[model samples]
Target: MTEPQHILVLGGGEDQLPAYHEARRLGYRVIGVDRRPDALGAAASDLFLCMTTRAPDRIAAMVGHLDVAAVISPASDAAQESVAELSRLLGTPYQPAPDAVRASVDKGWFHTVLDRLGLPGYAYAQSSDEAELRRAAADLPLPVIVKPSDSSGSKGVQVVADPAALPGALAEARRHSFTGEVIVEEMLLGRHLSAEAFLRGSTLATIAVTERSTTGAPHMITTAHTVPAELTPSTEIRLRSMIMDICGELGHTDGPVNFDFVVDAADEIRFIEMGARLGGNGMPLLVRHAFGINTYEAALRLALGQPTELTPRHHRKTALRILTADTDGVLLGVDGTDAVRALPETVELQLFAEPGSRVHRYTQAGHKLGYLLLVADTHDALRAAQARAESLLRFRIEPATPRAASAAAPRSEELTEQIR
Candidate 1:
């Protein structure tokens, strides 16, 4: 008899739930970590602890006495470097160099890398203080975006339409930044897309292209994401070529990478940002439903020192449409959750808020109250599933504390400052 292989998963949160679930499907022993005690992923883990997944040194100490097989984190940017650091210490196959992971976490380092690679990116200036930031913004193009250099989930992102709005936007962006630094960039307008791919020891596996739609502005909470993003063959090939160049430059090995881009009216693809992990917002999950391939599981296999399966098993149209509250209130309940779940088109449904739970309009991914995963054989069927979701599933909210209601309202890209 063989002892089960123990895998150290770096994050244990709702956003990381799929990783834990996939580990179980593969029958691997999973040890999960996070900062909170009540995290949903923690509950699903075989062993759970309250610890910051960002501390690589501390994590290394935790596994000091154990013969851990490999360390990996799926759908996590904050855990990327930690995983790399620990795996390097352990001499594992899933190792991505610490320098590359660090650059991914620090916007300043990321910008420098992109410039060196001659990747098409935005003109930007970095500032550490209000006085310096204000002075820097004064000269940049109008309607520039202000955001934390070291944060995720659009936490303190804001748009400054005019010079007068720069001060407030800077304050918000600074608040979310752990380093107290922010970046201001030239705002470009166009369609938002994400390139989902894998890097296996320098070889690129261009898997899926995703269409990203977010609330117009002011926190830019993602509203809907369509998998296998509809793209002309020429456009897809161009995007994949650009992605291969990026991965080649970054030196990504044995893991997934997600990149967001904006294609302007001129058809030029400008880089929005890059995340060196499985994409959040139900992306890896949607890929599994539509293509019958689980990238998250592939990450685990890579950690286990095995080859991955990237071939498409089925061709289906899929969408992950998230619903947010319109106003601040207590959730009464979703009307047809069971019905939505029963529908054949419904692949998965997750409701974050329960009856009497406080809910409100979107500020970030956390503010979303519920989500519906849909799958169909045709694009038209996919649209019908989304439409049925909107009609049958409803959020019942009555007035509560208006704090959430007072969040920044949505604005158009032209009307607000957009950033990478």
Candidate 2:
């Protein structure tokens, strides 16, 4: 009899939880590692290893101890790096080399490669100094975007209209960037969508496409994602082809990759950015619900050198809407969860923050308090249900006073610098 496969999953965020469940459902031995002892995914895995994903030596030691058949990270860059390093040490099949992963993580390198390949995209400049950024702002067109070269969850992305505010925006971007390098580029105005693809060797298999709804201005964090994106068949084909070309150019193979793009009013698709792992915050769930394809299972199979059955079993529309507070304050309570749960078509409702926990001004994806997942027979129906669910939900926070607000303002910047 063949031995059961053992897979090591890095990090214990909600994104990695589904992979852990899927691995167990497939009868694979699962080991999860996270720095926080209270990480939710850790509770669901066969073995929970408490450690940071960036500790390469420690991760390597764990992989050796487990004799893991394969190592993978579902939706985190740190986990992706760990997977690459562990794979190299264990002589296992990972997605790419450390250098390739680095190229993907660093936004500056990613844009440079896209430009060199003559891909349809805008130019970008990376700078750490205030003077360099001011110069770059002067050179670029108005309404350019500023963001960290290596960060996720739309943490430091900002669309600046005036050059006078460039310095403050640059400082904000730098606060979220570990490398202290920020990229300023021409902002593409269009409909935002995300595409996921599974690669086996040189073959790229396109997954479902979804329309991404993000909080406009002040916060560009993704708020909602709906599958079977209201795109015509031809447009969908064109976007998928472009994404496959990007994957080929990047030499990404044998795992899941997500690409975000902007479809302008002219129907032209422009690149935004791409991640080497699965999309976060219930994206994999939507993919499975819409097409009956399990991204988590496929990722594990590919890492183990096994063939994946990339067949669609059903066609249904699904959506996930994040619940965010409008202001910063202490979270008093969450009401209407039970009401939302009683509603039809509401598949899941989860809250990430606890009572008494402080909630900050909505800045990025991480600031979201929770989310609701829904499904329906049609896209319109799904959207309607989502609207209803959101209406029934509420997050109550104690309003801050003037003196308290002043004290809280510094906390935001401090937290931002820590995450960087």
The TM-score values for the models, in the order shown, are: 0.89, 0.88
Which is the leading candidate under TM-score? Answer: 1
lDDT of each: 0.75, 0.77
Q: What would the per-residue lDDT of candidate 2 be over residues 1-420, giving only the tens digit for each residue?
A: 665567888888878887888888877888888988978777798888898887777877756755578787887865667778787887776546444487557877877666766767786788777788788778888888899888888888898987777888889899988779898888888898887767666566647678988877644678888887888778887777776666767777566887788888888877777777888867877777777888888888878777887677887788878778776778778777899898878877778789888877668776777768788988778878877776767776664556655764454322221010
Candidate 1 per-residue lDDT, tens place, 1-420, comes to 666666788877556787788887887777888887867767788877579988878877777666677787766777887888888887776677565576667776777777887877777778787888788778878878888887777777777777988888888888888788898876778888877777776767546777888886666667888877777777777787877777777776657887778877667777767777887777787778778887987878888788888877987788888777766667766677788898999988987767877776678776776667898887789888888767777676654545535646423321211111
Which residue pairs come into collision in candidate 1? Answer: none
- Model 2, position 9, has a per-residue lDDT of 87
Sliding window of 10 residues with minimal summed lDDT for model 1: 411-420
Superposition error at 5 for model 2 (Å): 6.4
How many steric clashes does model 1 contain? 0
